[model samples]
Target: MVRLPLTPAEVARGQRLGALLRRARGERSMLDIALDAHVSPETLRKIESGRVATPAFPTIAAIADVLGLSLDAVWAEISRPEHDVTPAASAHTRPERLTA
Candidate 1:
């Protein structure tokens, strides 16, 4: 399968997703979260570090569930904003933190 290169917008969104998941993780160990999410620690690490710019949906959903983030919130965090809103710009705004 040929995978196209990610656009700048996609890269930006992936970074935002990583940051949001990291914040929601708070004080938890990455290993613990990764194990609970049924993903390898390295996989989680890559996602959190934005090395995997466009991860599979199931992978993200599992990680988000482990972090107690709603899909809607995840979308809001990573999706491009319309009108005057910018996803990166919105990242500057504080979001509700999640706890284990």
Candidate 2:
């Protein structure tokens, strides 16, 4: 299935997510994590560089599993601000439908 297009906000969030993951991966070669997650090192590199903005859930689950991160926590951390009531929330604020 074709993945939905990401809005500017989502792109920014993906960049932030990449940054966080990169930070968390300090000292560990990308190859190591890629091997552990059963993904290609290039895939990990794309993810960390925000080249692949919306990775599959199973792919993310695998990466998170290797990083010892919770799916909920990952979602919470990357959600857009409008999805939540908090002043600085990060919920998925964009509309679900695609615009022309």
Candidate 3:
């Protein structure tokens, strides 16, 4: 299939997703997390580095599971564009706070 180029918003969201995952992963080795998530280290690297701008849902779900992150939390994170990209702000903010 011919894929259209990603818009700026999509690319930005992907970067936010990557940053969130990297923070949630903390000091854990990427190899270990990738293995546990049943994905290749290269895939994890791409996602974490924001190179794979719109990863498949299953791929993201698997990695999020390994990182002990809930989908709600993940959405809450990447959905917010104006918030500061801190680990605490990204991983723990309430969705309502996005408007507050």
Candidate 4:
């Protein structure tokens, strides 16, 4: 059966997911992680670089499993605000109000 191409939104989501995975994988060799995930190093490289946007679900599951991270956590990271100001603003404001 022919698989349908991914939508633009799905591609963006996949890229975001890949970026999150990369961040969580700091200090780990891509080859090692890929081997653990049961995917080729080149495939992992492409996923990390967002060259292969919309990677298969099983592929993502494998990577997430090897990373020891939950799927929900990965999705949450991807969906997090690109420019999260709440934490930064709260850090400054919370101290002032408590002192005042």
Candidate 5:
């Protein structure tokens, strides 16, 4: 099977996901959490570091379960559109065009 390169948006999303997971992890040791989630510590480390940008669904599910995070919440958090500026903010700033 062939894998395609990830877009910048995907990379950003992965970073956000990793940050969320790290915060949710609190003071728990990565090894303990990984063991509880039935995954290798290295895998968890990679996920937390955003090295495994798009992890397998099962792996994410397992980690979410161990961390007591709802899949819906996780999806909502990660799937939010990246808004560079609010409507009011955008009104104040001039839009710039890029020339190749």
Candidate 6:
């Protein structure tokens, strides 16, 4: 079956997902994480580079589990609109004081 092309939003989301995973990986080697996730290093690299934009759910779950990331949080982060601020970004912003 021929797969339909992904929308630009979907591509951006995939890139965001890859960025989040890479950040969470910190100093760990790609090979180590891939081995722990039970996926080939090449597969992990592809996912990390956003080359495989729509990876299988099981593969994502496995990687998330290995990385100790909350799948729900990952979904929430990646699902937000491009113009919206992420929780992480918002958290670092200064709060406004209420003037009575």
Best model per lDDT: 3
Q: Estimate each model's TM-score.
A: 0.79, 0.71, 0.83, 0.70, 0.79, 0.83
What tens-digit string does per-residue lDDT give for candidate 3 at 12-51?
A: 8888889988988999999999999999999999998999
The candidate, 3 or 5, that scores higher on lDDT is 3
Per-model CA lDDT versus the true structure: 0.78, 0.70, 0.81, 0.70, 0.74, 0.77
Candidate 3: deviation at residue 32, Å?
A: 0.1
lDDT of 5 by residue, 2-100 (tens): 999999888877876787678778899999999999999999999889898899888887887788776665665667677731212221122242111
User: What is the alpha-carbon lDDT of model 6 when measured against the actual structure?
Assistant: 0.77
Give candidate 6 regions above 4 Å deviation: 85-100
Per-residue lDDT of 1-100 in model 1, one digit per residue for the tens?
A: 9988999888877888888888888899999999999999999999899989798988887888778776667787788553424444343333465332
Clashes per model (N, Cα, C within 3 A): 0, 4, 0, 0, 0, 0
Which is the winner by TM-score between candidate 3 and candidate 5?
3
Residue 16, candidate 3: C-alpha displacement in angstroms: 0.3
Better of 3 and 4 by lDDT: 3
**TM-score (C-alpha, index-matched) for candidate 3:** 0.83
lDDT of 6 by residue, 43-94 (tens): 9998889888888888888887788776765676678889976644431122
